[model samples]
Target: MLRARLTLVLGIVLLAAGVAGFATAGRGLRTTSVHVGTVPVELVRPDGAAAGGAARPVVVVVHGYAGSGRLMRPFADTLARRGYLVALPDLAGHGANPQRLTEAALDRDLAAVVRYVRGLPDADPARLALVGHSMGAAAVVRAGAADRSIAATVAISIGDDAAAATRPGPRHLLAMYGAFEPSGIASTTEATGAERVVRVPLVEHIGVLFADRTHHETARWLDRALGHHPQRPVIAAKGRLVPGGLSLVGGLLILIGALLSGRTGAAPAPPDRDRPGLRVGAVLVAPIPGELAGVALAHALPNTVTGYLTGYFAGCGAALVAAALLLRRPDHPARPDHPARPDRPDRTARLARPSAAALARAGLLAAAAFAAVVLPVHAGLTDVAPHGPDWWVVALLALAVAALLAGAHALLGTPWSYAAVVALCLPMPVASLIGVAPGFLALISPLVLVLVGLHVAVCAAAGRPWWRTVLAGALTVAWPVAVVLPVLG
Candidate 1:
């Protein structure tokens, strides 16, 4: 009881600190939603700038693949504080945009944004610049090469596409990359004949976006290219990320602990009797079939990332079901009132299998807790809320995820089953990273591991049953897959 009380108090404090930190970072910024045709955009600038004020130099920042305008908020905020009017847009198929994206569409959408920004009353049309990361980097590099009017270009995490933009002109190209990035990334940028190149140290890929040095370097380069300097010091807020993450973990600890307190009696838990070696070995290969199925089926789906996820979860469900059938055994009588004996703490003793009502409660608790922690952070960091046909995808994916979790519980049992969960979930994303699945999976795969670890740790601490834990875990993992991936018709 005392430990739980301490946890509750600590969690509240951390959550408050994180929320306050994020709010403080945005103190002098004004953000508004505007549209370029059907494309949604976030227009960010200094708070006190008047409605029809003198035109300021505009910098349109674009996010990487599977990312939204919000994901590029760090860049937007930094440049806005430096007195640059920044425009962050949801490319076709990403964030709030309702249109599907394609190879040709990326350029078209970027062109639209550029044209619209050039027309903004507060924008200096002649001094327009672009800053893009990854896929967006490729887009801007191509844009800068083709359009002589673009005063400057900043490309971060650029790929082979940079080599293709070979238009030779007086382009003020600034190529930025993490030192830890692949060697090919540097060579590609160099091929563009960038006037300035920066390799931000001790970071790679996503880290480059949040790095303080990366933000500073980008602002400085743009200021030089557009020939504009801030009258005030550059405003930076990368420090808020650490406390925000801490707040998420703390909030989860409180919610899971409180919800599962009924299952975690005051008495100490008994020791495990199951063989650790056998379970570990079984779990290692358990997800292989599902991964194979998902990878194969993903090729046929319209929505690249979400399509792969759907197939992946379905494959996992099938594998879990097969494992359950092969490992079926007699059910143990309820031991709700009994303290599990140390030597016999296998499936029957530990699982004790909660009632239907209890499972429902657990599912509800997990969903609520997962949403509280994940949704706000996701919205602030990435895209807007899922809408229109997105809920249909969420419903379907949730069922498959639930099946995968339930089957995992049946085979691995209640205690230490998180290892199995991680093993089952990680392979598809890795396959994607290596080009076996949709390449975009690399963007979302890390989140899978983080969410899985979070769910396992919180549930384990709260002493929830395998079924209940799986229920919670399924919902927690599924929501991101549904919300983050692009919606294609």
Candidate 2:
């Protein structure tokens, strides 16, 4: 069992590593780290190293606001596979770059990246291309306008500044936006070979680089504009994203196998008495404390990422205490005549067996489910809470978090179990507001609320009628309840 648990954990870590390793793989391209004074960058070159290689066509990719260079790896990989030297950099206040970030600093850092790419030994000065996503969009457009040496520019999801992005183009320009972009924003085409593509399905701003349409069209435009084509079509590249996903699947199976085999460490718990009003009241009332605590922490903590993280961590701890205290049953005076009695040996055995194992298994399964769902989405949406994370760093950190949660489950009851599981999620709403990252609470609120509501109904079910009420409530109002915070914000 210990060996199997270790196997499952290690498998999850390896899966995440696979996602990263495969994304950067191409025929002769090599990714390396370089810097220009204060700014850090990833230089992807055609051969082993950029040094001494002859000048080649260059493409510089920049990430959006609050995002790091990793978010653009897919796009960088595609361009590099086609033989273009790629420069992926973390703008000021992002990735490994400087922390004292401002708009002016970001602009300066981008200019430096352009200079680095153009000055590369094998870079083709005349075949340079500049690209950016979201906030990086405006930066790229401005950079292109200032530098005629650039051969083309692509801005994914640029807004109403069509003239700004297109008119100052370096021979060719392209704009790409997702289907859900605001009304009145449409594709663009110009006589100077400028064009736009819109309506890429099931994608939002964070997903621009991951979309097939973005890669294919962007590659085609680059080849045409730079007057270079790959010797062969690119395939099997996206297979890289598969391993991490599969690793998660593997972890899920191991856990399911454990639970099904009845290796759960704890005893089964008796169901709670049915209280339909209490169930309704819990879901309706939970968010107030969650959000209010979040807002309070936001102000109390220092205005920095470290502070942001501290406040959220503290908030979770506080919420755990609050939930435990609020839901605790009051003690009654014992009758003088009554005395406590020891349980029978067999009854003690039965109680201990299912309680710990069952709880641990359920907690582990919930955690595994979260990793499987969120990390793949994280791959596509690296714009969320990114601060230049390494391949195995988050995996290891998450393990520490799980261990901490197990401690909570040991100290408190199952209600506290659910509280700890959801507590870490509260910081996202405030984080989104302060611009550390985006699309966190907005995306997971519904899922979390549904889980909370279901926990309420199932655990508290008195019988069939009460169970139906809980299920009906969970189905009917979960979405609206979950999305309320985002709507209010």
Top candidate when judged by TM-score against the true structure: 1
Question: In candidate 2, how many Å is residue 40 off?
Answer: 1.9
The digit string of per-residue lDDT tens for model 2 on 1-489 reads 665566556655666565655454544668789888777788876565443454678888888754677667777667776677888887776656644556677779888888877777677888899888766776787778778777888877664354344554644777777675433233421222345544567765555457777788888888888888675455332443455356544544444334334334444443233353443344334444444444554434222222232333334444444543455444443467864333312223333434565455445444544454445434543423333222232332233233323323333434544454455555555556465433333433444455444433333221211111222222222222211111100
- Candidate 1, residue 70: Cα displacement in angstroms equals 0.8
lDDT of 1 by residue, 371-470 (tens): 6567556735666467545567766667777777776666666655666677777786568667777776765577778877777776676563556666
What residue runs in model 2 are displaced by over 4 Å at the alpha carbon?
1-27, 48-54, 159-171, 180-194, 235-239, 251-267, 271-276, 296-324, 333-489
Residue 360's lDDT within candidate 2 is 58
Number of clashing residue pairs, candidate 1: 0
RMSD of 1: 3.9
lDDT of each: 0.74, 0.53
Cα RMSDs, all models = 3.9, 9.6
Instruction: Pick out the ten consecutive residues of candidate 1 with the lowest summed lDDT.
Output: 264-273
